[model samples]
Target: MIVITAPTGNIGRHLLPLLLESAPAHDEEVRVVVRDPARLPGAVRARVEVITGSHGDAGVVDRAFEGADAVFWLVPPDASLNPKDAYCGFTRPAAKALAAHGVGHVVGVSALGRGTPLADRAGLVTASLAMDDLIADTGVAYRALANPSFFENLLEDADSIREKGVFTDAADADRRAPLVAVADIAAVAAGLLLERSWTGRDSVPVLGPQDLSPNDLARIMTEQLGHPVRYERQAPDELYTTLVGYGLNEAFARGVVDMKRAKDEGLDTGVARTADTASRITFEQWCAQTLKPAVLS
Candidate 1:
């Protein structure tokens, strides 16, 4: 059995069909733990066994993990909640359930910057790494898909990009950082879950093809969307205030500030992508195919 959590989320939505298509060939049973069964597409609901509840619930995960060989884990973000409680608190129950249920393997969505000097101060990244540690301690074969800032994050401000022809962030305008597409992240997770031979704990850095700064992205956006687009670097204080205004609590807002600061300081630049780690989608392709359409829509 292969258990998947957050099956309706950005990555999970893409992951579900890939796993289902391969299930018949591999003879794998797929199970999903979701808060809202209704949110699952009708096609998916008919294909996999569904456990209706949040994965953070011990009962939900324990029931879902029955006879499970591999599990895809992703702790969805809640900006209104405390960072530690949101990440590590939610993970503890699932980790305990994994040990109790004897699930063999787990693929968790986590961030980059595990061993770096800046990791300790990288706010949400720090909390996520700590969550990874708790899961690793459970003795399940674990692989944390350590990703950089997602290209999908741009869609959150698609309205601004379309209306004002501008996007904003706290990072330095010229500091290039890896940005990955969630589709590629899902693909890697599906591949790992399909082949359950791997063992022990490790971090898989799913860096996209190359680094691109926000300025570089704006230039690309201009060409791709056939309109003027610009990158605006907000002051750290301004960014924090803006996030708080968006309903994020102060702690979570501070975490976002710290993460952006770490990126500007080159925290994500340290890891060079290996052949197996590098995702094929480039920022330009993602802009043309994903971001451009999102802006138009």
Candidate 2:
């Protein structure tokens, strides 16, 4: 049996079916841990057992892990003041549950630049690495899916583009950072679960396609939308205030600023080599396929 947490989330929606298809057909079962089964798309609900409960709920997590051979785990980012404590509190219980249940393998959705000086500037990626380490300590075989920034974040700037013809951030418009499609990340995660060969504690970094700066992104969007779009660097304090005004709490806002700082400092840089890792999707294709639709919508 395989258990999936956060099944209705961005990656999970794409990953669940792949997991089910990959499972051995005889008596294997695919289960999803969800807060409300109704929230799941009707198609997904039809295919898997929906165990309703919070990820942090001991009884709920334990129930989902029962007889499960492997699990896919991820935690949604929180902007609360006590963000770290909240993360540890939520993940620790689940780790304990996985330990108690003797689950064999784990595939975790984490972020890049963890376990380095860049970690502090990488926002929640740092906390996620810590969470992965905690889970690894439980003696379960683990794979941490360390994905770079998601191209989907561009969607948040749609309103800004429509009104201001551009979006503002804290990075130099010329600096480039690799961006990945959430679908590609899901594909990689699903592949790992199905293969289940690389065991023990390991981090799998998924670099989507290429490095792109905000200016490059704006240029791509302009060509796609048939309208002018541009990038501008906001003052750090102004960027902080804007994020807070956008309803992100202080801690998350700080984390966002720190991530921009990391990009500006070149902490997110890396060369793409397809040999040592999995194949990745490109930014231009992502723009044509995913970004264009979201912009038009």
Question: All candidates' lDDT scores?
Answer: 0.91, 0.79
Leading candidate by lDDT = 1
Provide the RMSD of all predictions against the true structure, rounded to 1 decimal. Answer: 1.0, 2.1
Which 10 successive residues of model 2 have the least lDDT summed?
Answer: 270-279
lDDT of 1 by residue, 75-94 (tens): 99788788898899998888
Off by over 4 Å in 2: 24-27, 270-272, 276-278
Clashes of each: 0, 0
